[model samples]
Target: MLEKVYPPFIFNEFDRKNKFGLFMDVEKVIYSGVTKFQRIDIFETKAFGKVFTLDGVPMTCELDEFVYHEMISHVPLFLHENPKKVLVIGGGDGGTVREVLKHPSIEKVIMCELDEEVVEATKKYLPNLSYELNNPKVHLVFEDGSKFIKNFNNEFDVIIIDSTDPTEGGGGALYTESFYQDCFKALTENGVFTAQTEEPFIEKEWMIRAYKRISSVFNVAKLYLGFVPEYTPGTWSWTFASKNIDPIKDFNPEKVRNFDKELKYYNEEMHVASFALPNFVKKMIKDI
Candidate 1:
């Protein structure tokens, strides 16, 4: 009998203490190197298409990215009556920008990314996500996100923080209370602000802390869930904060129903359902 061998699997150490992690079969490495801020890896996986990872953590992939990008952009967009100017912070891959461009009413989108190399890598290897980054209405700014918003007040209609996990590399400052205050000051009167809050199933304390901080800054703060298979535990959360708009009570489903773009994961019903939290998640954010 002949012995069989398989390619090695790549494991992401999401929970180091418990030794819990997720693995993907890497087909090929498109690009791998240490950028100025963090380690960037672009690889083709058997399960998902080309994936972008920072510091050994899965960020986004071609397969299930629409679920995350659409939910993050469209939820607050539809809730707000007319969103003209948009700002995206730390989404170097351009997935969030692509989704933001779907709304016809948007006049401009400014994407502020900390690392220029990440944008270069995405533009080279991940064209599907990065193609829209060059659109006429999109402006790419390579700078620190925490400091970028300080220059603006009553500017953007919607601000999306499509950043990596807070503890990973330099993204920790993005989740701070002061940064949330800056985001609150940067938005217009009816502006909506949102960020990718960590998965509660794996990082409960982080989620609670983020929720408390955001709640304290914004007049109305709420947490929503989305299913991103690439993320640990197959679940992800996003924090939505607004100066005046109520995400649920003020949400207009007709705006979403009238959206011309073809969406994959997010829909009118899912928009409402996404806000309905499970018992544990409700309990987690209740006292925070």
Candidate 2:
């Protein structure tokens, strides 16, 4: 440990400050890390003890995890007429796979999580979200998501990219045009893919660019918003691309079975409302 001792001259100058007060007690540090990664706790009241923040920023937790997981997984599943096979990229928590299994039509769900540590962490601290990791229909792949999609040949009905912000180095490829092309290849005809885009308020420029790239590859590309407080600016955005399906017309929630009865954010009304963006958001995409 590094320490410093104050010299007599410096101590004399510091003592001259009238605003100075005696030191108070220090508290325990729960979690700490740099931007590439950080620690978070999931049981704080203000956020419903669902999610936790470390170093003053929310990283991951249970409270708001279901919102993103359920929305990204079920939206495309509900829309598809027969979603037999599915692939998930970067959802190490297994929350997305858990929701996908609720659908009767799904036969197999393969997930590619680069970090086994993330899976281990979420399983230890967020059991509610990680419970379905060992389900029979679920197959875990410890590998690179972007690269994994390249070898896949139109074998899936839906591909959900539950990735972190691309600003993180490991998640960076998920935001690129090349990755979108790989996703395009990985989907069967009429297959749809959805991903959590960055905060719309903070990343308007990047959002526009992402939409343009997706549109170029697929016949339909759409952006939708869902509220997840743990993320920045309170709300978040998700982007979808489909070979032949229009996400709005493809919604069919009557198919979801084994309902958990614990969802806080997603519902039929919220499903329809999520696609309805405000005028300013419309303006940003219209020009592009």
Highest TM-score: which candidate?
Answer: 1
State the weakest 10-residue window (summed lDDT) of model 1: 1-10
C-alpha lDDT of candidate 1 relative to the true structure: 0.86
RMSD of each: 3.9, 8.6
Count the clashes in each prediction.
0, 3
- lDDT by residue (1-288, candidate 1, tens digit) is 101111345555554543786677888878887877888887788888887888667789988988889988888888778889999999999999998898888999999999999999999988888899999999999998999989999898999998887764434888889999999999999999889888888777888888889999999999999998888788889989999899889988888888788999888899889999999999998976
The C-alpha stretches of model 1 lying farther than 4 A from their native spots are 1-7, 13-18, 168-171
Candidate 2 residue lDDT tens string, 11-30: 11122232331121112323
Among the numbered candidates, top lDDT falls to: 1
Residue 210 accuracy (lDDT) in model 2: 72
